[model samples]
Target chain A: MSERSLIASASQTIGPFYAFALTTNTALGVMAQSGAIGERIELVVHVVDGESQSVADAMVELWQADASGKYQHPEDMQARNPDPAFSGFGRLGTNAEGEAAFTTVKPGRVAGPDGGLQAPHINVIVFARGVLLHLYTRIYFAGDPANKLDSVLAQVPEERRSTLLAYPDRKRRELWRFEIRLCGEGETVFFDW
Target chain B: MHSYKRTLPGTQPNRRHDAYRSTLLRNPRQPLIQIPQTLSELTGPLCGDNPIGESDNDLTCHFAEEPLGQRIHLSGRVLDEDGRPVRNTLVEIWQANAAGRYNHPVDQHPAPLDPNFIGSGRAMTDDEGEYRFVTIRPGSYPWGNHYNAWRPAHIHFSLFGPSLLTRLITQMYFPGDPLFDFDPIMQSIPDEDARRRLISRFDLETTVPERALGFKWDIVLRGSGATPFEDAGK
Candidate 1:
């Protein structure tokens, strides 16, 4: 790589009172729109702290491919049909109970860096008042058969792999439950830049 | 060719800084695991159709009357690490009104909120990677972070560069703000020079005679470095 002169500027917190300015009259947190083809699922994410206390200020942003295993981004120069209804972008802040739920359809398999197929997954980034720099992670379905074949998931430790899995709820036919522990025991795995 | 540079350690604020009390419980203790940048990192959502409005960049004229405050023009370019222009990116900004009061239910600060000012704006960068906003200077506000914690006058900035790795959320400060030394959020950056990057410079060239003062702060985001070809020689 060529040597660069400017270094990227440091990041600052979003602060507590960013709700009014940041999320005013925009698509708050709708991931998959109507007419999008895929298994419609409601994903609920809970955020907790080292003391097991709920963190109410955290905001989660997720990006994934459509049901046809294709991203609608320009960088995904693949030969596949684009789902006009699916935006593949989901954003929502946690409530007082530290829950951020999304009405999104299940993402399909995507390509890895080396051109191999990857497991169905969602790329997640978390931002909060306390999170100085945003944290990166991924969410994978619990019963996905392709999990074993994911190269990225293989890099994570076996014990810590559970931190990335979102288990299906027994009562809700299309509900999946995932919790992110910021620190201490059972802390969710965070990826570095 | 689309790979990014590794972050220099200590340049960023610690997630567990003790001064910011909110970080005590919210910060993750474990070290972040390093991984290869996949397609997810290489690409980001293209906020297509330009959701920004014709006057979205100007926060002063949103209502029937002009807001009460010192008018200013905030302008800058979105550049990559190599100072290359990052074109067609989305830039979103939010701030307190001129009275240091946010138009939000959560802000309990005792200040008047201007009915004409919502304190929120969004704009898309041009081919030159530049963005301009016309708004009043936001006032300093007190916070419950600590005893008599008054935040410096600043505007919150959110940007989505071409790549997901380039996503950023930061605050842009006015030049020579008195709160720079006292604010934990400003002091959180370990490097003094890096912290100065957050402050905008007063530019005389962009200043209009009687209309608005001008300030410029070019933001730099993570960029793709030129990939060296080694496999060909081997």
Candidate 2:
């Protein structure tokens, strides 16, 4: 911890050939172990570019609270009842069709910045070749009762709010499908700190 | 848990730079919305110190035989903009083999992939923010970016500092590479010095006599803004 000044290193694209190394262990993509609690859902994400074409090289990361609204992190000041079985972190790379899927328990309501209840949601970060900087966004359950009063969702425009929701697939009751558009119409709502 | 701070856009790469062909339709034209840094943004995975295996940092020792090409010792520190140590953070790296061929299925490059080398490694920074790895120098490879375009040999890096805002994924290059001039990705950074930071310097101190060469490159993540830099031009 010297007082020497150093500039933060700049970012570069991950390039097209990083899949073999970065995504070697796909087991990290599975969040819910056998005994994890809460509602089990299959989370599937499909990514598309402004050209309405699939982005096959993208990598998606998910971080969230366990079923009890407790994060498996030391920084979670109020996670007194953290779930030992839930790590709440997962990483997966998209396939040829620009799709990545995960099986995890749905998060519970957590306190917001104002100490109010927030909707159960998952924090998502996207990394891909040509994406100079990683993109930040969140996934909210479509038609959830908490969406009406969630703090973060309120920040997005009413019209674009639909972009954050994940609709239930027609055939599977516990399956949720989300679409992330990098640009053009119906672009996903990205957040910044 | 030290939080990240201060975003100086000029010092970073642009998201929508057009020289890179893939960014054309994948970059967002809409502005990012500001959000409160609550539990989600404030916290990250609580991976214990050095969760990686003992041999994980030594990419060259995976197979029974040694990997071909120049074996090098790559090491460095992880610091914040405030010059404070970012300790116990995970540092993951991936790169092309010595022959510039990847083990991936999609890489159609004619270069050969060393069976002994996997081209990826992981390590955790110590209490002093220092990390090290034993790997071979990756070779320069051609890409579809432009005619006769060759990318400077580089190792891809990924790290998750304490908080989500501190997370980063970047690259590390060799000292003097001719491809820097032609590669669109390396040219994407506007500032010359900032781009130069990506190039690791040859460090004789860390070099092994007959075992491996040594290179040093420090990664500075976004952190709280302090007194403005007095040495800007130099």
Candidate 3:
């Protein structure tokens, strides 16, 4: 076999329709029950193949606490303010080369383990074949002063804490960009069961 | 004929074949379909480095094939029980080079190798399992086991079947390869005769000698599989 043969073999394709919308359209952290700060933000995640540094095919799922820091899942026994409009969950699969994009609203603040509250953000979980299990991480908006104060963000060791957040483009206003690399250089921290 | 004669397994007439014959006569059951096999077929379009679109200036990396091997125009149609050509079925294939070393990250077995040989490709079974690919003859490689370890030149295949759960994975070995006697993955199947099913038959009708050696290996996935998981419970 020649190098040409190997190069010829490294191609793949993504299907026509995105898989998420097939089941649910509920956006994660889109609102509070009373419909308070329902501002929408664009979220983009780039999935990469750790071994080859190539984009990998993957599926992404996201969910989070609502404006009042609550989830509507029926199993939750805590008598919290449940937002019928905001289910606090959403799912998206990556393209053939491991690229997934989500256009969703930023979730508002909620109470943390400590008395201090946290900022509006989205929680992201990714699934690919290489990893033995699912990879879980979070995305925080840059430029938000509350980001520095968010208790969850503060707890992640300094170097690792940055991996869970994204930088904001000042000129673009609400626009923000975040890329998650699965392996190789600058790999995001992953948690285990 | 190389001055050789082969003996049949159970045809030694008056010899004491009592126990084996008695068991076979009592059992009367055929055990051919119970074994498991791996599927490594290829389907879909011939891939280039860039999957986005047809770009003439596409970056041909060190591992990319600039002009790939001469493609053998092998084409065929796959029909179901009802004789309908099954459309949209995925076909995949992987094989050794004239020297063996899968173009995969996990395969590390060494042999005089072609650095550019990826030896893998795919084509979708048209409204039938009908599909085609352009590839070259894979080579054999040494498994480094001194006592006995060498794999015959073969191709791995996989089929998506009709559904997610219905997928099937298998491999195709070239016949007349003495290494088949020592390959572990092959021996794992338990049934010696069934193991031969994985090796392709040397069909003179399909092989073009100097041009290309062609083999038709068809597969059936378990059953109509399920769709992609939708939510938590699902």
TM-score of 2: 0.94
Residue A122 miss distance in model 1 (angstroms): 0.6
Which DockQ-derived CAPRI band holds candidate 1? medium
Worst 10 residues of 1 chain A by lDDT: A19-28
Share of native C-alpha contacts between chains A and B (below 8 angstroms) recovered by candidate 3? 0.00
Candidate 2: which pairs clash?
none
Over the stretch B112-204, how does candidate 2's per-residue lDDT look in tens digits?
878898888889899999999999999988888767878899999999887777788899999878888877787788888889889999999
Q: What TM-score against the true chain A does chain A of each candidate get?
A: 0.95, 0.94, 0.70
Output candidate 3 Cα RMSD: 19.2
Per-residue error for B157 in candidate 2, Å, reads 0.5
For candidate 2, the lDDT comes to: 0.86
Interface RMSD of each: 1.3, 2.4, 23.5
Q: Per-residue error at B103 for model 1, in Å?
A: 1.1
How does chain A of candidate 3 score by TM-score against the true chain A? 0.70
lDDT of 1 by residue, A59-157 (tens): 888888888888878778788766988878888888899988888888888878667988998888888887778888899999789999888888899
Highest-DockQ candidate:
1
Q: Which candidate is the best by TM-score?
A: 1
Which ten residues in a row are the worst by lDDT in model 2 chain B?
Answer: B225-234
lDDT of each: 0.86, 0.86, 0.46
- The candidate with the higher TM-score, 2 or 3, is 2
